[model samples]
Target chain A: MEERTVCEMCDNPPEDEGYELPLCANCRDELSRCPFPLWVKLISGLVLLLVLIAFVNFPSSLRAAAAFERGNKAKSKGNYPTAILEYERALARFPDSTVTMAPLAAACGWDGDLRKFAYYLEKLDGREIRADLADEIEEILLEFEDLSEMEGDEQ
Target chain B: MIIPGRLIALVTFPGVIVHEIAHQLFCRLCGVAVLDVCYFRFESPAGYVEHEPPRRISQHVLIGIGPFIVNSLLGAFIALPSAVAVLQFEAGTVLDYILVWLGVSIAMHAFPSVADAKSIWQAIWSEGTPTLTRLMVTPVVGLIYLGALGSFLWLDLAYGVVLAVGFPYLLVSLLT
Candidate 1:
């Protein structure tokens, strides 16, 4: 028996039914012509251009979250340098973002970068820390003490 | 494993490339005035082709399918020589064998391309589908691609898996 592939957009057999995940045939035909008046197209084009510029120029909130994820992953893998790199990236992308700062500071503390941690703490707005995160950071710092001692002995 | 990783990387590189090319190709075919292409690579690189998004879903789907169609052919070509070289690898040094394995692995996993993801995301976000339909379609489509590939065994499959996992990270970095 031949294996059948379904249409990706809509969950139907692509061969048996006309494709409609993105659009059916009639809808596709209709969209070919500009739906807006000519003026609307011009205005929307200009607006989109502006939005594009702004999106690029602005500090990215999404990047902050991504950086935090990367940092967490790196920490779990015991890659302190990589974790720091991710945190630094987050800081660069979203200087004023609290979400970036808190985890970044925590990572720095774990890496024994006390001065860096202090810097991030200073920059952080005075929001109360959640109990879970505060405890986690404390544990990371305590663990880092042993890590640094081991490194010191190895040297 | 070494050969597989390299093959996987080789296959993976083209997924992003094909996705962009698909967009550009469809624009030209639709008689739309092509302006320029802005391309983004890895986490840091970003660029775009200078044409408006197509008004029609058919045009969009054509562009979306471009990467899958192109890369699948490319993957086949890559896999053929790689498999041959791999079979002839008895005399090869450790490094030579490693390279071959990497190459083969990457080629095998190099498909169901990310252009499909972008196409799905755009279709969901556009006025093309009703709100309820859009909600239903977007996650379902994304999960299908992602969930299916979670267990893919080949090297090229690994590349696709990495891309699937990493692309969202890239998107978050770029969009936010």
Candidate 2:
């Protein structure tokens, strides 16, 4: 979704602030009316609010966007597992989404899961992969081959 | 609401809760009083935990173990039947729908909050040998969480379902 302010709890990127977990002002005020303990009600309200926002903003078609964002962040942070998780989410939701699949395959290639990279590449037909990403995937394949050779030597 | 739905993020949050519940259960096993537990998210969504601080890594790990146990069991129990029903039925009936819903529900729960993950990561990072022990436990935990994610990926529906289900895990993971 749109990042508005620094998250209230964790002060991360400035883009994610201001807004409460999921609710904008309109929704939060309504939830505040619940009869539960003020604190519990508030938290429950906030969480529920976030859910609503997620649904509205992060629709099926946009899942690719979410995946792209997630993969981008995870790749940058060296969290390959997490990045792949996001890319996988994108793939599942938007199976035909070429925008995300290419990057995701490149990421898989980086992780040495060439089977998946090739799988997605085949899906790409003759479409050109991004120049930079193609190079990156090629580099990874080379490294993976070299590593396997090293393993062979050790054996 | 949308945000709480995010709270239920697949890999990061639901998994974290399973892990935390693991820690909580072990704490109970070891005779520790459980106070409160939370995982964090940011801006519109976050989590918190207010608990009596444990003096030992063992206690910490026990609480961490909570989500792993919960999700693994949940994944096996819910996903199995759902898988069967989905396979057996061509066009879904109400009951099949219910089963599918149940399976998705269980599967959606397959992650940890990054917030909680960070805390555990910190706990592990801060300790040397203790961290190794924590690392050992994490894979077991992640395996179950992965099962939950696998279920969702296999089922593979619309983005809203995945995001509604998966975002919370990421939110929790990333924020923490």
lDDT of 1 by residue, A1-155 (tens): 55446533355444333333334333333333323335535743653454344334223434545666778789778787788898687666555555556666777776778898778767754766556666767687678788889999999
Q: Where is model 2 more than 4 Å wrong at Cα? A: A1-155, B1-26, B37-49, B127-176
Q: Please write out the lDDT profile of model 2 over residues B1-176, one tens digit for every residue.
A: 12234434443443333344444555555444344555435322334444433445555555554554565455444333223223321222354345345445533443444444544555555534455677676664465455435534542223224433344335434533
Model 1 alpha-carbon drift over 4 Å, by segment: A1-155, B1-15, B38-42, B45-51, B87-119, B128-140, B143-156, B159-176
Residue A98, model 1: lDDT of 56
lDDT of 2: 0.50
Give candidate 2's TM-score: 0.34
Tell me the TM-score of each prediction against the true structure. 0.33, 0.34
State the lDDT at B109 in candidate 2.
Answer: 46
On a 0 to 100 scale, what is the lDDT of residue B94 in model 2? 51
Docking class of 2: incorrect
Task: Specify the CAPRI tier of model 1.
Answer: incorrect
